[model samples]
Target: MEGTIFSIIPALLMLVLVLLTRKVLISLGAGIIVGALFIHDFNLFGMVKEIWFIFYEIFVSEGSLNIGNILLLSFLLLLGIMTAFLQASGGSRAFGDWMIQRVKTRKGAQLMSAVLGLIIFIDDYFNSLAVGQIARPLTDRHRVSRAKLAYFIDSTSAPVTVISPISSWGAYIIGILGGLFAANGITDIAPLEAFIKMIPFNLYALGAVLLVFVVAYFKMDIGPMRTHEQRAIKTGQLYDPNQDNIPGDLGDTFKPHENGRVFHLLTPIGVLIIATVLMMVITGINNTEGTVNILTIFANTDVNLSLFTGGLIAVLTNLLFHLQQSKPKANTMKIIIEGIKTMLPAIYILLLAWMIGSIIGTLETGEYLAGVVESASISPSLLPFLFFIIAGIMALATGTSWGTFGIMLPIAAEVTSISNMDLLLPTLAAVLAGSVFGDHCTPISDTTILSSTGAGANHIDHVLTQLPYAIIVAVAASVGYLLIGTLNQVVLPLIITFAVIIGICLLLQFLVKTKLSDE
Candidate 1:
């Protein structure tokens, strides 16, 4: 319950240091240390002890078992296992070969990547790693820029998951809403129903997903993206020499077995997807109290357990397939363990993000920000737009969408209850949409980092190239919220939102011509 000024200091330091140094770990570490010192009243030794205690709780104590961290870490490890199996079994290479046949143009490559990302909507972490691993070879073969590949994966990852009903994002948001409702004693609106109602109003997610389609289908590129794409096509370089430090071998790294079949790759991925759905279905049935509809079952299911179990089954299925199909038959156990090992870096990063989020929670920065929002004389008609912008800024500053959701949902729930109950759905959607919008825009976001790692794109290159597109989506989404706040028609606002998105994209396409289009 610190004042807003003290609560915001650590966050500002985090953002400023990261922006100036581009060293996320070091910057965050410094900010955390400073926050500790402040909390301990500038007692240097006490501050050290306090910080150590925080790390101990995060890394060694039961803090690691928190549901949010567990789901994210599980997804990352599962992705590692799947991607490693795909690569080791030549599934990725064979899949790439198959893609090259159908995806002859650069647009096809990018669109395919986006489609794959959308298809794997169970979790954003899984989507980014899997799609990037599968799309890299295909995109490279077609001379598509890696930054564009990163954008395809990054944009689709969080946005699609946030908007997906069966996704971890959905489950988490609902859980947050559930807490907010129960605490506030708002009996009129059920959390799950409210979340579902809010989906269509999640303008940012829709804008982002549709923006990808528009950009790729129309061959439109803007800002640094245009320069990167032109240089890539003109020079046959996937990365800029100055900004990109990728090893030369990354593009040519995939090599399939001499007799590898596309089925070798497809079977496991197919199994994984099917298994995930089945797990959710069965888990829902088991958890049900009485007769329930499909939507209720989905809302009641445990997303983390379902995802982990499905991922494990997929890995085993792939191992069996590799054992049966590969000529010499690779070491299934070794490959499995090695594949899991491939995710250690991402795992550590997730751990850091979780720890930082926990620290921010301890500082009560979110509560302070929520108070600031509450203090504002924001009109009922302007609430959705204001909430969207405020939530976007919070997520952008913190680089943690889940944390942002935890912070904003309660405030949104309070605001809707106190002022205009009809604004509930739109306000909730704005919070979710803005969180995702900002998450993709920030360089320190774990998903953004994973997207770069998966696409083999330089981190800054990915962030820089993707921001303009994200801005366009954010602007359109904010306007959608404005329309919702005033007119309060979901369908009409969505239609108008897309119209604005398309118009902006079209204008950008004209203003930013592709240098290679002439060639």
Candidate 2:
């Protein structure tokens, strides 16, 4: 019990800080400090030394740029730079202007923005910033508050990435499934093959996407989100008290420069998508051996080179057409630099997140947590549900999906073997679902924070408004997983379960409306 308490101290500390002050960065920093202190047991010198060692291991060790951490960091940087460039070139603003020209109603703008987020299923970080930056002006023009916009963006980010097979997240999913296979003594299956099999089992991710569509198409309102949405429509005012008397605001400022064009915006993003897919295919082919497979190519290859190549191509394409037609060459450089600067805060936070994850790894918290779960001797029949719940709790507590997946994936595989279960799909699904659940609710989570920032919603406000919806979907997903496990059918039963869940929630809303009218 004492060991377990110590192991979870960082998580507890983080939650306390967040609730007390509503300062996410401070809360995360406090968690990291607590974890370090736990490692050192109040010895000041020992804590300092451990911190130094953890930092060194993360930045300088051979394992530092391992597939999971490297891919995570690479995607974040790419997103930051891409977003910055898009804004700097006036491409995003141009796109927004073009979108507004097409959509006359608030519902149409909201629906279009949601659809765009769904299409950009590359990385959650990319999805959040891109959708927020592009749709903010239009949503605001239609009197959609940043909170609602952020909610839509946040809803799409993790849900879309987990379901897509050709994303930065796909690589992580592959890695986790591979570990599960190795643990279960199933060495014959390739990682990619395992990943493919598990897709149908990822119920929560699929359900969340369905939920987003339902909410958008029907304009369903629930809890605080419903109130905010109505207020935004009626008065064009966000729920934030601080949003008074600001002129040329988030909406007004986004008016496009007269010189902006579609090519200026589309070219770089197009190049990025093409380059990423081609590189992934190239790496996958090079890494394949006879019966054995070398999955390291996903991590070991120069992801930075790929991102830089794509970004540079986009920038060049933008300058050649747009800049040459309007501004001088010097002005183009300034735009690009400014774009990069816009993503700097996200970049800094990402680096800190990586460093903190490394420190957690050093503390062996995953191993300790795994021990506790195993000792509990949970039934095999209940393993899927248990896995989902535990993974969710861990992720929520730690405020990181990557960390949750990294810790749980290997342990889940071990449990599968111990119970003589098919380890690949179920374990993968558990990790993915759990990670997303935590990412959804944890106030300290980067995705959650980014969503709030992107939408111009107060971080706490976003979390508070989003929690009940997340819970509704999560409970539905839990039932869906149980049916999947019991029925042993992959997609059909799960799909039906998801539909039923959403239907029930919508029905309840109707009932509530009828009751209110009767009263």
Candidate 3:
């Protein structure tokens, strides 16, 4: 508990190691070990023992037996099973075939991919893999670059989910805030109510999602993305010239079964989404004695529990109905196992993210950050705007939005009570938006890695091609946040934020057009 600025060293070491080695879990483990060593004053044996104890605490501590986390993991695993079921059942194949027939142009394929990205809002990991698996074949048929496909996937994954109430990211954010509220004994409003208000104010998420649409709609690929797109159109080359190392088999052939129909895919997905909503309402209304406001219903809604139930029901339907018609006719057991296997990397990343968050918490990183901000003696309104940038930097440096959110949201949220009540929405939005901006673009982010794998694109190529676009959108979002934070009294902040976003994007599009013409 006597940590100084030196406590920041472990996270910095983790970030640098992850960037250099591209091994996130190893880097995080190294950080935890190093942090423990630093805490124990450089004793190697003690460090090893402390590391063991950390694992034990995460797994076995009474406080660690948290239902929110367990439910989050369960929901994640269930999504994996459901996605695998779709693939193994030839449902995704059938659905792809149906879409490919209508999508003959490159622009159409990319737009449809964006639409699909919005629909798969249950989890960012699910969105990344599902969109990539289903859309890659269609995008390839239209000669769209894999880098662009990865961009669509990455942009939509974390950014869209961060803003959506029904996603894994929202669940985690609410859970984190719930703990903060309990700690501070603030019962005037629920965390979910606060989160819902923050939704329309999340400029980065909206900007990033809309930016994906604008780029796809106009086919104005800027910088490296433009190069990749041109190469794809002219030479039919999807990967970058210097990047060709694909580490996994991004192999999903579109061989629809004789018995398969679009219903095979559509029905299960419909069940999942509908069930999730119904469960949320039923659980929420029950919690609120059936007479509360929409805000309260949203606040009381059980995201992790609802998602788990929805995913479980959806996967069961997939196994029972769709798998029987696919090639090889594997039994339910094999299909279920295969479905679960697809989610291992994501689940592992999630667990490690939690561990890293715990390590950062133990080091009091947020307290240090809050102290630094307070010492700056900034004005009240300027603080929310500045915190948005701060959150983005933390997220980008750590390569994990969950870690960033855990380290920053409580400190940022605490400021709301001391300031204007209206300030709560933008500050919450800032935390969500900034984390999403970093997650959407960071090369080491799990969703970023997953998107590349899913699109069969080179990881570095995906990052390079997408980075310029992310930066443009991030800049636009930062300006939008500044306007919202400072000028909400004159006009509706959310409306102004979006208008600024679109204007910035159109201006950037023109710049890209001029640059390409000069080239």
Candidate 4:
């Protein structure tokens, strides 16, 4: 028991660091170091050896070849290359310029930004950075706050990716559910089929997206967001005047043609979308034997290759389309290199996150957590809700959804199987939803940090302002999950859950408005 407690000290330390200082990389590094100390029992030489072993395992050995991380990095790299190319060719700028010409009001600009986020449902990282880069200037011109812009970008990130089937997140869900199905004695169903079955039950992800649309369309603001919005309106300084201004200069270097052709912008994005879809299909086909198991494909296929292939297609389209005018040869190379450079920080963080997860895995922390939960003998009926809440807390505390998923999914799968509950889909959904919920609110979450960076808001400022809204949504999602688990009926439960969620949001909006007015 003492060992178990000691094993978790690193995770706890990480939480304290995030809450007190909000320095993500430092927090993550501290967690890794603490975890190593525990594993090595304060043996200085052993700790050093462990660090070397972990680094080599994660970056050089077979562990580095893990499909999920490879897929994630590949997509990020491709997104970087494509985004750079689009900026260089003036595609994103041209579209933004056209939208600016059409949208006359602040509300209109916000709506357009939300709509674009919805449409670009490829991946969370891609959505967060792309939407922020494209819409920030437009929203700024319309007097939207950096906080508000960050909120929009952050809201769209997980919410959009979670719902979209073509996204890298979708692939991960398929992989996880596939494992759950096999473990639960449902051997015949294909991975994709299992994933599709869980879609209706993914209340949080779907509900979050719906909530974003509702909030945007109704022009609702609550809590700190309300404060920030009003500040933007009164000061007329929507964009952060003190932002680093590097991306802006980078943007200027890639000025689009005077003609502002929409095709120039649409073509590359379209190619990227189509190529990614085709690659997924090919991967699915190549891995699917007569058995149709999802894990087989996840374990076998090269996800990085797929992403690289898609990115190559996108880059080629950009070069081919832009070559008709002045050759952007130097600009093309610069854009790709810049895009890759932009992703370096995220890549490094991801590497650290993976290393931490690997350490935790070696310690069998999930098994320990599961043992404690099982021994508590919590009511089986309450298991689903408890799972949802626990998963959220863990993810929030850890500040990494992928890490949360890695820790919780296997344990949740075991729990549902042992209990003989028919809540397999709900359990998986709970894990995914909870992880994302935690990621949404966590001060140290990379997604949150990226959103702040993209929106040019102070990282802590974004976390401080976004926390209330995230909490509100999380509460709603918890209730929704409870209903889905208890009611055991899909349609009626969904309706009630959505209605309650919306109602809560409305009530919160009213309270927020009243408070703002009082102030």
Task: Give the candidate number with the greatest TM-score.
Answer: 1
**Model 2, span 1-519: residue lDDT tens:** 224557777777777777787665677777777777877777888878877766565546774454444555445444544554455456666776777789988788888778988987766765775566567757877787667777889989988887666666776767667666766677777878777677767777777777777777777777778778878778778656653321112323223456666566767667756775456556555655543333444433344455445545555665565545554323555555554454455445555555566556556655666677878977666667778888887777666887788878777777777774664467567678877987898776778767765565666667777877788788877887777666666676577758776776778689869978999
lDDT of 1: 0.77
Ranked by lDDT, the better of candidates 1 and 4 is: 1
Instruction: For model 2, name the residue pairs that clash.
Output: none
Please give the lDDT score for candidate 4.
0.68
lDDT: which is higher, 3 or 4? 3
For candidate 1, lDDT tens digit of each residue in 155-188?
Answer: 9999988877677677777768888888878788
Q: Say what the RMSD of model 1 is.
A: 3.9
Deviating ranges (above 4 Å) for candidate 4: 1-3, 63-85, 113-198, 223-260, 291-302, 319-324, 327-341, 398-428, 443-465, 481-496
- Rank ordering of all candidates by lDDT, starting from the highest: 1, 3, 4, 2
- Considering TM-score, which of the candidate structures 1 and 2 is the better prediction for this target? 1
Lowest lDDT sum, 10 consecutive residues, model 3, at: 247-256
RMSD of each: 3.9, 4.8, 5.0, 4.5
Q: Which candidate do you rate higher for lDDT, 2 or 4?
A: 4
lDDT for 509 in candidate 4 is 74
lDDT of 4 by residue, 1-519 (tens): 223755566777876786687565687788888778778778888877887888777545663455555656666666666656666666666776777789988888888777877877666665665567567757876778777777878888887776555666777767676766677676767867766776777666777777767767787777667767877888985544553332222434465555546677777766766776567557866877765444444434444566566667887887787667575634556777877776665566566766676666666565566566656766555666777777777666556777677668777777777774677667777777777877877665767766765665656557777777677667777777777677765677567667876888888778867876999
Which pairs clash in the backbone of model 3? none
Q: Which number leads on lDDT?
A: 1
